[model samples]
Target: MVLSQMDAGKALTAAAAKGNPEEVQRILEELRVHPDTLNEFGRTALQVMMMGNAKIAGLLLEKGADPNVQDKHGIAPAHDAARTGFLDTLQVLVEHGASVNLPDQNGALPIHIAIREGHRDVVEFLAPQSDLKHATVSGQTAVDVARASCVPHMMDALFAHVHS
Candidate 1:
């Protein structure tokens, strides 16, 4: 049962998006599909993968998926993980060399997203790795995001990593 290139790309991305690491692994190994294969929509498996599934993230990454791969919007897997509060997945991505400081088209880094979303744990994890002084397109830093969030814990967590 051989699949066309398009079919294989679709299957790979679909399996990743579903968080089925087994299926994703099978598609990559059995189909000889590249881990970075793009779906018909021009998005890679990592871009659409389940943000909470660190296993899937690890599998894709270990198989050569680009850790820095980004969507047209400049949103990387780390950004998605941070947005979804999946600290484990974000950690896996960073371990694979994803840049925590990579900003999206809006100049929003993963830390900014985590802070704005009130994910204190995620913010804490990202704080040390992210450029806290970097501003978003709107000229807002991570501190500004936490301050606007009105979440004291978020500020506390971010401030804990800030040297100054």
Candidate 2:
């Protein structure tokens, strides 16, 4: 079925948000919608997609979705995945060319968000790939975020990566 761009965006974004990979696939394959199509809210499927769904993340990315697509807040899929502690989904996004160094509106990179959110696994995955020197608008780097997170050993985890 042919769907207008608006309808297609809505349908595709909705399917992604619901974590229904099959429905997302059907919408993309059958509807022929662009993988980066924006919903009515001006957000892409990747932006609103369930962060825990690595399968959906892979499918959308395999279909050519923009891994770096950011929302109005400048939060990309990687940022969302880090914030939500979905390391697998984040890895998929990074494999699809998402940049761990991309900053949000607050100048916080994915690593910064992972540290602040106490997502140690996510932080570890991003640590080697991220520019550890980057600082947020608030002047916080991954180290600073870890210090404030109060999550025991968060700093040690970052230190392990930093030293190596």
Candidate 3:
């Protein structure tokens, strides 16, 4: 019953995975945990939220969790959100100063990850603000990744954004 006694990092991660804002805030208030604590895999609560927890992501950002923290894989929280096409999460991170251009270990930016995953809406959202010519691990840009993944709409969107 004592949420404070629970592992704050674990609780935060679980809350992030569940997108439970209330539980997350409770953990923060009761546990006095560091919001940016990384898990064994080097993922922070914000990163976990970016993976799929829009509510928790918003909460964490509103609570002042660092938006620029990277996982062990060197992927920023925004990158994870973009990779998963979590538009709301991405927006929250962005509003909190998450760098839109941070690259992952493979040199893939958030837009590149979104394109590789064939997330058309994410690509559409990111395209206007991104440099589609940016390269990745294999020297491929978002358009190249979209083309290889057979996502014609993403490729077209990137192309249009880059050209226009």
Backbone clashes, each candidate: 0, 0, 0
Please write out the lDDT profile of model 2 over residues 1-164, one tens digit for every residue. 67888889999999999999999999988778888998999888999999999999999999999999988889999999999999999999999999999999999999998888888888889998999888899898888888889998789879977752
What's the best-to-worst order under lDDT? 1, 2, 3
TM-score of each model, paired residue for residue: 0.97, 0.96, 0.85
**Residue 69's C-alpha lDDT in candidate 1?**
92
Instruction: Please report, as a residue range, the 10-residue window in candidate 2 with the lowest summed lDDT.
Output: 155-164
Off by over 4 Å in 2: none
Q: List the residue pairs that clash in candidate 3.
A: none
* Model 1: how far residue 65 lies from native, Å: 0.2
Cα-based RMSD of the predictions, in order? 1.0, 1.2, 2.6
Task: Write down the TM-score for model 1.
Answer: 0.97
